[model samples]
Target: MTRIPELLAPAGDAAALDAAIRSGADAVYLGASLFSARSQAANFAAPQLGQAIDKAHLHGLSVYLALNTLIAQDEMETALQIAGRAAERGVDAIILQDAGLAAELHRYLPDLPLHASTQMTVTDRAGLNMAARLGFSRVILARELTIKEIEGVTAEAKRHHLETEVFVHGALCMSVSGQCLLSSLNGGRSGNRGACAQPCRLPWTLDAAQKDPFPWLSPCDQSLLDGIPDLTRIGVRSLKIEGRMRSADYVGQVVAVYREALDRLQDNNPLNRQERDRARERLLLAFNRGGRFSDRPISGQMGRAFLAGSYSGSYGLFLGTVLKSDPVTGVLTIRSDKASNRTVTRGDVLSVRMSGEDKERASAPVGKISQTSDGWRVQGFHPDVLRTITPGLQVYQMGSQ
Candidate 1:
């Protein structure tokens, strides 16, 4: 009998926590107010952490606390204190990156399960062995591994009795998980310390003649929805979605889609083509880079196509190209493609993007939308916002509400 992999979701705040529970996450990973990799997120305080854990437990969900940042010598005691509090609150596990901290937690709180964070850069059998020696109960494999590599590692992990976790969806860093220093080198913020400024998402240029600033360091968001069957077959313990800085809506929608997929897999009813297409569309509507979801196979090598050089941030659902624009009237005539079958209605939030532009364009709610024989005529954006629009540009649905 194949064991279904656990569907893990991310919760950055109370709303996201509720969203995860309502959307049906088997488990949730969240951070405290301090010492989290996503320090910028509205992390929970000690009281809030206790409440969140209680709420999740009521829903039959496990909560894992993230203490996965590099702890300085002086911060070691405080970090241990945080871990102790979480353990007392009945956190299912604690994820860690610092080996020294892991040793301390093992010695002091011997019963608390420790998960080796991907930030620990564990990839091979040797790393798995090291994690076991350090008293870790689980090891999150690095994101750079191909499916074959993951299979090999999972087999070896069983020998050490260490469960394995893999990232199934969300952002992928250009550099390896734990080794990135570009943020600290270029800016004062250190990714290891959980304060990345995301300088890689910014546009850069190699040639002065180039007109467009390209996000060469940014990779497309990972969507392994299609790979769930394979992962389950290989006995992966958990499938994690990576977004703590994203909105509650994003967390809910993405979790719902993955939840359905996992249920289908467990029931042995794999998604057919049309079902897969609809799932892909729902995911795109929730959030996406301006690229195909799951651009590369889980087993294939990541190449140039994996890079999201064209756009770095979420553009939502791609509507169509602008055939004509009237900046003064704030109307756009668009040739609908991917969103042709979907209905466009009033109050829908829409965004426009021009080729070679790196920054997000001004978005506005639609006051009017009418389908034409050839395309759609959308109206009611602020003229000031429309002034940036032009023909031959792309449009996207940022939100329906």
Candidate 2:
């Protein structure tokens, strides 16, 4: 009779919301247009949000609206109004970053549960106690905590009758949550106000040369797919994924894997090696934006663990190396380790990068494929690429199929 922790997924819009639920999410957190951490995401307008809450409720999934952005002096009314409307729509909970907003919401809508957002940067016992005292029933721990730190925080929260939630998977920022000002400094878009321009994803440079050619500042995405059992055993009430800005396909794939993993753990039958490998493939196809991941943040592997070449965004899965190419013949030879020509699809986009430096690259959609003596010969390389593509370049499939 072990308690299976809730599987929470991100829902940036109506499409992502549907995908999350269909893929077996226990609960979903989403942006409410104005006050979302990911302002760039396709957040829900007020009306759309109401509809979204109803839709998720229909599937028996708890919908937690993200009003986690810091409210401005003149915008307090709008912030309170948004929380009140969400409560009226029967939202299961509201995630809060600003203590003032949480207090107002709790005072006005006492029945609605408030989950303190990771944006609050909570880690220690004192912070958790402060959140509980401020009327928060649950607290989403900061992602930077080590595994040991998390166990301690969870134990303390339990003592105060407060539920603990943590980010088991997804992207990590260079700065701690709610502490980053790089985006606001580089561009006028403030990360705290929900208008982060994601400056961390871009290449940084010194006066004369590029400082970190790769995304050295951007931490690798987290993947605690193997640690589900330990988290639930330690009394972690919810496992949250952090990708409201990602695609529905991405949300669905991650949700399915984590859901399956949680169920298997609950039944005391973890996925076998082959099954785990297959799940990893599904995740790879869905989105592998960053390179390597750690089980916990304090490992200090964030800077060194990034993917090889394409560090800025989704580089998809690396297929294989290009053996040969001919601009005149309009054909390129590719070698895949998977030994499956079935992966070829017309119009499938691919990034061709020099094996040495992933920066020198060009992407093209696959037009046609034929079996060859050595491997599969892909024709119709992107017109811009046919001439420039060189042999021995690594080709990565971008995005999901």
Candidate 3:
């Protein structure tokens, strides 16, 4: 029997950690107060980091400390101290990006398990071997590699007794990991140091040749649920989900979906497309960047249309275009487009993204639902939004559902 790869989720905070554990994560990776790539997230402080590790251990889930940021010479001692603290708390592994820091860690704590971060730019079998040689037990592969590339690298890695993990789901960067200078040169915040400003997510106007503004850089979030079986067969050890800044609700929903998908893969029954479709629907409704999901780079078609530039921000799921509306009666008729069968319950929130500009014109919760002679009416467009809803606007559910 093929070994099932671990479902590794990100936990930005305590709540996110709880969600991952309860939603069925096999292991989780998180950052402490400092030396983390996602420094902007609500990272755990020293005390909180220890508490989180203990909490995760209580649930019988392993916690990997993310010391995965570029460390300066002066900060080396502080980083080591944090690593020492992480070791004291019994962290399963320490994910590191800096070679100097890894060397220091190896010198101080020779027995500690180290996993090279994706930020380390480990792409090929040689990079994997370097990590293994440097005393790293596992290596988180770079996100931009093709499936074929990953297969070759993993094969070589396992021969050297190195574990291989890859980002199976979550946000995709436009540039190569740790090599992006847009955030650093453009904003003084280095992505390699974990303080990325996410300038790529913002809309941009094309050069003078074409004066059109679009998010020409933003890549769609990754969803490898369907490819889990294939990847595991190829000797992948872990499937990572990348949303440390997400809400607990989002964390729980995504973890549950992937966990079930993994279970189905390990089962005797054949893969069910309909069941997977339903799971994806729930995933999209819960949280997604462009209101839709996409697979990783595939053969012959990998180069085309991976970017979600038209709308730079999260658009949830595209509900439909506005058929008609009345600002006076507080009712708007909309025929669902993306998923016609999708309905808006009382708790559900929706938004309409103005086409071509990457902006939201009208967004609010569904106050009431009614059917009339004219059409099916959705009530509760904010008072300010009614003036903007003229007609022919695309509707998408707001994320954090």
Considering every candidate listed, which one attains the maximal TM-score?
3
Output the number of the lDDT-best candidate. 1
Q: Which of 1 and 2 is the better model by TM-score?
A: 1
lDDT of each: 0.86, 0.80, 0.82
For model 3, give the RMSD to the true fold: 2.2
lDDT minimum window of 10 residues, candidate 3 = 296-305
Could you arrange the candidates by TM-score from highest to lowest?
Answer: 3, 1, 2
The residue-level lDDT of candidate 1 at 289 comes to 77
Tens digits of lDDT, candidate 2, 67-142: 8888887898998888888889998999989999888887888888999999898889889878987899999998
What lDDT tens digits, residue by residue, belong to model 3 across residues 18-81?
9999999999999988989899899999899999999999998989999988899999999999
Point out the worst 10-residue segment of candidate 1 by lDDT: 290-299
Which portions of model 2 show Cα errors greater than 4 Å?
Answer: 206-214, 298-303, 306-310, 326-330, 338-348, 370-374, 399-401
* Ranking 1 against 3 by lDDT, winner: 1
**C-alpha TM-scores of all predictions:** 0.92, 0.90, 0.93
User: Whose TM-score is higher: candidate 1's or candidate 3's?
Assistant: 3
